[model samples]
Target: MANSEPGLADFTKHLRKWFETRQLSSETDYSEKLWIDIHTLFQVLAKGIDSTNPFSEAVCEPDNPAWTLRSHAAEFKVCQRIVNIFLFMDGLHYVNNGDWQQRYIFNNEQRLEEYLRCMLGHVALLQLYGDNCDHIELVRTVSNSMDPFREAFRHADISKTCANMNYRNIQIGTKLIGLTMARWMEQLKGTRHVGSITSDKPVQICNQGQGTNTKEATADGVRQNGHMPIVEMMEDGTTDVVKKLIKKGKDMTDEVKKRLIETVKDSTNPEKTMEDILDTVSKCTAPGNACVQSALESVHTSVTPVPPNPADHDPSAISASA
Candidate 1:
């Protein structure tokens, strides 16, 4: 129990206290406050779904902060669960999002869809199962609820939409749903902040995923014969990892930023421009990816609109005609 870690001890204590409070018989009947709050937060997040990140855009300051939209993604799940207790368990509020289709853009007839999805995600892994499924059943109670997951799995195009199932049809894919659940579990299990720091430098990325600067730190560590290399790299600006990656020729154009603008296309607001897309991506680079991507963004967004029922080109007919 390396509870000595900076934020670990507090989380264990918070979990113990939260679960213990839920176990009390009286606690069950007290109120559904948490659930209500989470639903409200989802409403807020829903607005930002039209943007790349709702919570961060709504909350975080957009200066040259050490963090970016990724930080908001990290915080979203944990905050949602806490909000859920207030909404459903406390009865201080109820779990609902109005006009699921109008809100979700798929089932204009289903208002509760987003609300249901949020609640489903939170409670899906609660192990309370049969006992805790009363609300879950409401989601299942939709005319097509029994096969909602399947319908979403078979019909919905997920990669182009929010993994949370926004902007697209209610058809979020099965794999997307599972991955979303896994992220929730990771949060509940509290796996993000666990690890030992071998270096003395100021390392920004705690979760070393796609866009991490690990190479230079490791090299510096080897040459200096200590973790100090890592620390120095992290603190003093030895982004040798970035240099190596650049040399290897991988475009670190902050793919997340590019994807962010792409998400706006399905929005009901207006079509996205390529310039805006490239502009957002440019913001991600240390010096900004201005020169390289300026034309690319313009060209990317310059796609010509086609009629919904455009005539299909028959390859065989064309070849025969030729």
Candidate 2:
């Protein structure tokens, strides 16, 4: 077995270390970019299947007799591999960010074994096609493209971490296409609204015209006047993580706002100096009032509050008083 070979084992170990270094480095944008490559690889395999469909008449044009063989190779090669690879990389990314060694991998020995077996089975299928389909160009290309990924899966041994995932309360499978498909669909949902407004926020109506429309009754009938269309407010867009962070800090935010407005308005001092105003405003907003007193006192003394002009008062106030 290749697993028993010391040379291959040493190479795999070095490869893992290299992967770890790249994963940990700030300069490397690996996960998302690698995912895109995985997507392209799946597309290549799918296109291969369609191009080499055995039952389709389209394959007759310069096609070989091994169309069915190539189709089978493409289908099996792409069916569960793409999702499993994504699950593997994403789960490893998740686990590597925290201390979940015992929980995700080491504790589940039997599951790990099953995961490895399934991955090896897929890799073996690839190797078989590579050896037997030398005459088929599409299979050759597919096999060559998948070779590195197949080796990564064979040597990484993180299948169990991916196989039994409880992401979003749904169990993922490494061998089946349905369950893994559902998993990615659910994961994609969290990012679906990125750079878009949230749907739950209610639309705000705005009046766009200068005056309100009026209806008048004429001698024969009632006439209605037309008004401008209402404009809607833009909704706030945010991610799930940003939403959680905002929710967690909401109470603190409200408390700080309340303290700030109260500090600004709570001044009852009869003195009309800038120091007096700053001192009052800083009492609740500043930490340890004694520390900021010198800074407050040194502030420009020329800026004083101007008395409210009586003419600027609303006409409703004068009418109410009368």
Best by lDDT: 1
Write down the TM-score for model 1: 0.21
Cα TM-score per model? 0.21, 0.18
Error of 1 at 162 (Å): 6.2
lDDT of 2 by residue, 148-259 (tens): 4436444343432222221111111111121223223333324421112112222111111424321111101111211000000011111122222223323334444333
Per-residue lDDT of candidate 1, residues 1-322 (tens digit): 1223332233233323333444333322222332343345434433322222222232223322454447544333332332332122111222243211212422331223333343333332221111112221221122122123225324331111112222111112111222223233334334332112123223343223645454444334334532111122222222333222222223426563344333333333312342244344433443334433442344333333423424221111100000
Task: Compare the candidates by TM-score and give the number of the best one.
Answer: 1
**Which parts of model 1 have CA positions greater than 4 angstroms off?**
1-108, 115-204, 208-281, 284-297, 301-304, 308-322
lDDT of 2: 0.27
